[model samples]
Target: MRRIKKTQIAEMLLEHQLITKEQLETAIAQQKTSDKKIGQILVDLGYVEENKFLELLARQLEIPFVDLKSYTLQPDLVKLLPEFYARHFRAIVLKREGDAYLIGMADPQNLLAYDEFERILKAKINTALIREDDLLTILDAMYRRSEEISHFAESLSAELKPSDIDIFSGTQDFSSDDMPVVNLLRSIFEDAVQINASDIHIEPGEKVLRIRLRVDGVLQEQIVEEKAITQALVQRVKLMSGLNIAEKRLPQDGRFSIKVKDKFLDVRVSTMPIQYGESVVMRLLDQSADILRLNQIGMPKEIFEYYSQLLTASYGLLLIVGPTGSGKTTTLYASLNELNKAEDKIITVEDPVEYRLPRINQVQVHSQIGLTFANVLRSVLRQDPDIIMIGELRDQETMEIALRSAMTGHLVLATLHTNDTISSMTRLLDMGAEGYLVASVLRAVIAQRLVRRICMKCITDATLSPPEITWLKSLKHNEYLNVNYKHGTGCTYCHRTGYLGRIGVYELLPMVPELADALRQQDSNKFQLLAEKQPLYRPLVLAGMDLATRGITTVQEIIRMSGEI
Candidate 1:
């Protein structure tokens, strides 16, 4: 038997805190009986936590304990680490392009090493296993020089400009000159997928071209350049959507698909000719956004619980009312996800299906084919759907059909363009939907708005001025409670805007017997009065005020959007 060093024994005892001499002796005795590692013996003898042992081992070995699960390794960084470290640590460098590196390592079974690595790196590492072939493919895909990849992206973008896009679409009829345009169109579609845009909008102005992308329900400007490039980009988009390039005078619609990031996204493109040039809107259908859970949406508990109950109901028209860009689609999509199951048949009629939901049949409303909202709703009824989701109820025909579907037993979830729940009813009445029908068939109406959240890192306590304090005090009858406004201190985390992300301020109109009776009698005044009296009925202004009171959002946001509390 080899003699263990006294210093090594002391260190182990000190580190493991096998503080008792008897426990250390027991561990030593156990190590002799078990072929298991000495560290295992100490751990089994109630010595130290597994992580602590691993941390010690990492310090002894002078190597990183990698947990690949939480951390993302850029491709360039992988190339910077020594190859010996990669091989010894059993890591495969997936991508080592230019200055970026993406590395994948085996599970960090050595807890000590992982702790040390975490302390040193200050970033979490995510771990996952990959096949050798897949790893090799990733490595091969890495560009030697980042500039090459960047330039290729730039060139593809250049070719996608409005003028070039126009030329390409114009020449797609198989003329020898049309080859460049065909190639250019293919390249732009490929690039659009890489950037993860939900929709692409190409609007032509008098002297400028604007390309906007709808990402996560908000429109973001992707590119703004000269008109020629914008036209080319539009033409390229039209060609991919399978529209006639020369038919720019009339509105055209088309769709195409591209594989990106190991997933397929459907892109729907719409173009209308404006005075300057053709305007285009491309809607990207990324399924991931639709798969979000209800809790992930960040609504307050009251609103979330209220909506949850409304959705579980068997039948009723649950209308999500909001202005454009208020995340109504996301809320509707989340509700559909909640209702979707193996047993139920869910059908949706979207002007164009924006996102694909698995296990649900989505019908696209084609105005050209006379497959408008009314036609689709009529057709969806025959499909035996348990739930029907109309994208938007623009006119009387669609509104009536949707209401009939809900009244007859189908759960209808849809969006309407309005400022609040009350306004939605008025708008529906103005659109030719009978007032009584609107009252009876309506289950609940949710009106929502987005307000920026105070950046946690830069949030500060601020004393409110007399006017602000007076307004806040007016919110409740109890003027005795002390309250102060929270404002952002401005930091890099919040882009110096003092806000990091947006939270939803929701107003839910819960359907009660009294409210339903008022709607049935076409009594708008009674309905409003009842709504105000309900404890759960939170108007948009009150919701905004609640958010401001909690310091989750600022008073100014509430004032600007929903008016003073």
Candidate 2:
């Protein structure tokens, strides 16, 4: 048998049927005008799987292959080379062998990377093949550690004193394209993902740049530095979001995607010019994240059944009322999963369509181009949709359209910014909608808010205060009579915040015949009285109190979120 050489690896794989000739040809073609190895190129262009190609390379080179993603490295050995070199070479120090180090390279064919590692460490090294993405992932994770982040941030931030950071125009002296600044931006995102932040806020303060992570519905300050808003960091993020990097005068909206630890997340970025600099807020929308079902959203079992029935109705206008970030969109998507049927024609007009559901038509509302909600909804009606979901009932025109659609044999689902379910009716009337029209077509209203769930890893018996017990009684919920609720005592798994995640506290009000008749009569005062009579109608505060009794959340949240309700 002939020994396979580095140059012949692609040809051998082609001949061995591991890859098609066209795939090999494409990889070879991409090889030119590219610094990547033929093996890395092949794996990148979907011509071959990363692990499989690594196996083929290992077999040809007569060396062991390791999935660096799962491979752990000694931190001491990893520091053998500067991080800049490690990132540039896409190489890592795997382990030490007697008097030598076993170095892993994404492209072992590149002796330059091996030479750099050997020279930097000043040690004899044995090389092996590793996946490009895996090595980079391991390297990034290593640098993104809390201590490393603090040290690196401190190093770059040394020159960023109070007087150095300018507001209107910061020092553009440092080129934004620098490698270290780019890595700093990536490190911030990776750390955000690790901490399960729903959103990342990069704000420029008068003296310090503050980096905050919105976790479990609360924003916690993470990294703060005097020289936080570097021109390079701003330019790097602007480029990623596809916004005009040159034009920092106005606010911009753009989206970009990121892959952290094999999980792909889509970030919705909005940059607003602040006094110090552009305040960048990135909302991480993980497409690969779990699409929770309605039952999983934390509605009381009694209210969930009624809410599900509301979705089953053939024709009615259902409204979800809450403040921003109350998980209203999540509940709407879960309801769509239940209603999206092949036989039913469902269409939605969203300002920014968040999810893609099969068998349903979703159109984005570009108001600047005149594709407003009312206009798109009017167009959707022409599509003969059986169910219509208007992302928001913002204007009187949209409300009128939705109500008319619901009356004409269409199920209209939308969200409204209202304090409670009853207030939604008043908001519609105040928005110039006809009282009788709203009353006739309205079926049900759902109000919700999010509360942090107790971290199971650190859950301990909670001793409720006498005042808290008395407040629970005011909620009129019997579930808390003698229950020994639990609370998180703060643990690493929950970031020492006593809560790992959040769940919804919901209130569902279904339209009964009495309320419907009263609404059609244009008597909202009577309708409110009738709505309060429903046996299943529990206010959001009461539902949160029930969760408090079960140890799912805290009573303090009930007061903080739904005290007014």
Task: Give RMSD to native, each candidate.
Answer: 11.2, 13.7
Q: How accurate locally, in lDDT, is each candidate? A: 0.66, 0.78
Worst 10 residues of 1 by lDDT: 140-149
Model 1 TM-score is: 0.61
In terms of lDDT, which candidate is strongest? Answer: 2
Model 2 stretches with alpha carbons more than 4 Å out: 1-144, 151-167, 170-176, 226-229, 465-470, 473-483
Clashes of 2: 1
